[model samples]
Target: MTDLTEHEVLVRPRAAPEAPAGRTTGWWAMVLFISTEAATFAAILASDFYLRFSAKGSWPPTSEKEPDLVLPTTATVIILVSCLPMLLGSLAAARGSRAGGLLGTLGAFAGGVAFLVLQIVDWLSEWPDSTVSKDAYGSLFYAITGLHAAHVLIGVGMLAFLLVSLAVRRAAARPRGPVSLVAMYWYFMGVVAVAVYVTVYLSATLWATR
Candidate 1:
């Protein structure tokens, strides 16, 4: 082979950059997790409706009171509003704004705590009238709403971790992946909260009226 000239040196092609963790396995795993959770919620809600329609008496079985819309509606509003900061923070993190990410994470965490407090208050208010062992209506209501509360708790924990991480890590060292993942999870929680409100409170009331 002829020797390459100085002006025509062979150059190795540069390898493509690795994909961000947010767009890789982690992303798909989050999506799958959300899907499974959504299915679980759907099944439970469907059961609630089925039992409501099939029962020979009133939807709440007369002994149980219909869920009050006030507290849960407030909680739902908080959850949905919390999603905004998470989205903004994730977007900021992706753009390399660590301060924005930190602030967003803090906002989300506060909202989650607020929601849990409201939920607990609502549960306490209903405790005298409804308990899991009382009846089917009570059992299903607690099961659905409690399960959703557990999810929000988990998401709050995740946001707390993210907040700590962002606070401790340098701006250059911050990872957008975790922020994006947490944001997505927060959004899911918001959606599920609304669904729970609609199914456990609104739908039951409407069905009773019909």
Candidate 2:
């Protein structure tokens, strides 16, 4: 016969609920890397400002021959607004809706493509060297804007990878990691591009009107 007392003591308590997951350690590391990036951009911006102030003998030195920036400025507006689609894509992916996420990612990607094309068009139409002196304004303009464009290219690559991941079912099957990381990277790039657009492009373009 079973010993009732022994059996009663043998039963174990259910395990306590697991702790809620927090941001991954890798995500925190990404944040640290972004902080360093921000500092570097800030330094370049400060130097640009110093150079402009000294070269022109005034803020935005009226003498710099500003180019026709309408198309590129418009491109900047469209690109900045595309961040909404990227954010939506991230949320949709988190919810496990691959199609919805892909659509959003594609929309953002299209915007990026259009923006890049416009940048090339703008450059071809008005050689940067023609608009600003090669010594200071030209150097800073190309350096800063080129850096911004490089980041755009990187964002595009990230989006393209995400799209391929979705197409192959690898994304939904695994259903995390790559998309989330790409989204974060794209968002940071978009935000930085906006800031660069304002300081480098808008400010410089508008300076001509004054």
Candidate 3:
């Protein structure tokens, strides 16, 4: 005869799962920050268009010339290309590979520095005669591109800080959030850089030359 036991259970009792920590707040904060930045950039771009179309005859005036495209085009490519390494670094951090993460960040920083150097050279060569104080064209051109360049600088700084943190192994405990935020900011800056290139260089040159 089999004895029926009230305490007989096929499986052991398991502890209750821990509640997920609320992570949405950080993500929403980042989104809000980017949105505000985007709006400010939109206003600046709008002002650029308004000034461009409102000007008499050709934009850039006859005396001022369209900026040389070769260098600026190269810089745009470099800046956008850096997004790849930035992505890699973020992924590596999330995976908890300190070496891979550091290497990726360094690669991105190199690319960013190269882009900035090219920009400085291009500005010196192309805009030697053009000054922001000279006219609306110069002012808008400098304002838009300068703002974008500053964003790149900030992105690079973020990566540098991430690198330092990784070097110290501080992110081992929880690396996802900080790295993810930096990746988002980098991507936003890259997209905005493309827009700036199109507005300040491409459209302006095409319209001014026509």
Candidate 4:
């Protein structure tokens, strides 16, 4: 009677909306995103290795030595471990314990900050002119790692802000919003950190060999 066929509307199930399911969607999205990121870094790293190998002795230039990896590696370990608490925080948040979730996120954020500081220190120790050619390889190294570090810094700030929100009870009352997205970002930081570590360490090894 209302001419429904002329209007011709389409309806979708709310359960399968664009937002997708909660934690599971977040996990799958992180997986796909990181996979693409890994491919990009791999290309850059391989290209660097190839160039450096082309000129053996002149690769590092000998005037300068490789930066010590001990500290950065330690920081990497800390970050990797922080994943546990971040997960715990996510669970707490899902359960409506914003404060507890905040604590867990703080744990992860602390590790992220440590990684950033260590990276900055590593860069400080290596003068641009001293490292490799400082031409393509040096620039690429800085660009790749610097970009990654910037991402880490962003994640740290996000988690820290969320923590403050919890402490002040601003995130109280069932959260009108799911913290799933926030959790995704936190875990993403850790995952990317691992990828960066592997790329950097592998590059260092290849450089050592060639």
Best by TM-score: 1
In model 2, the number of clashes is 0
lDDT of 1 by residue, 33-127 (tens): 99999999999989988898889988877788777889988999999999999999999899988888888888999999999999999999899
Task: Give candidates' CA RMSD values in order.
Answer: 3.6, 4.5, 5.3, 6.6
lDDT of each: 0.89, 0.75, 0.82, 0.70
Off by over 4 Å in 4: 1-43, 46-64, 128-133, 175-178
The C-alpha stretches of model 2 lying farther than 4 A from their native spots are 1-20, 56-64, 128-133, 174-176
Task: Please report, as a residue range, the 10-residue window in candidate 1 with the lowest summed lDDT.
Answer: 5-14
TM-score of each: 0.88, 0.80, 0.86, 0.71
Higher-scoring candidate on lDDT, 2 or 4: 2
lDDT of 2: 0.75
- Ordered by lDDT, highest first, the candidates read 1, 3, 2, 4
lDDT of 2 at 101: 80
Number of the top candidate by lDDT?
A: 1
lDDT of 2 by residue, 1-210 (tens): 865685577785657998559987767777787778778778888888787666645444444456566876788788878888877887888888888788888988998898888877876675743454545776777677777778789889878988998988878764455667777777777777777777777777666566
CA lDDT of 61 in candidate 4?
48
Question: Judged by TM-score relative to the true structure, which candidate is superior, 1 or 4?
Answer: 1
Candidate 3, 1-210: lDDT as tens digits:
776465654454768999677766778898998999999899999999998888997887777767778888998888788889878878987787677777877877888888888878867875656778888888887888888888889888988998798779887567766777888888898789789888988887898767
The ten-residue window of minimal lDDT in model 3 covers: 3-12
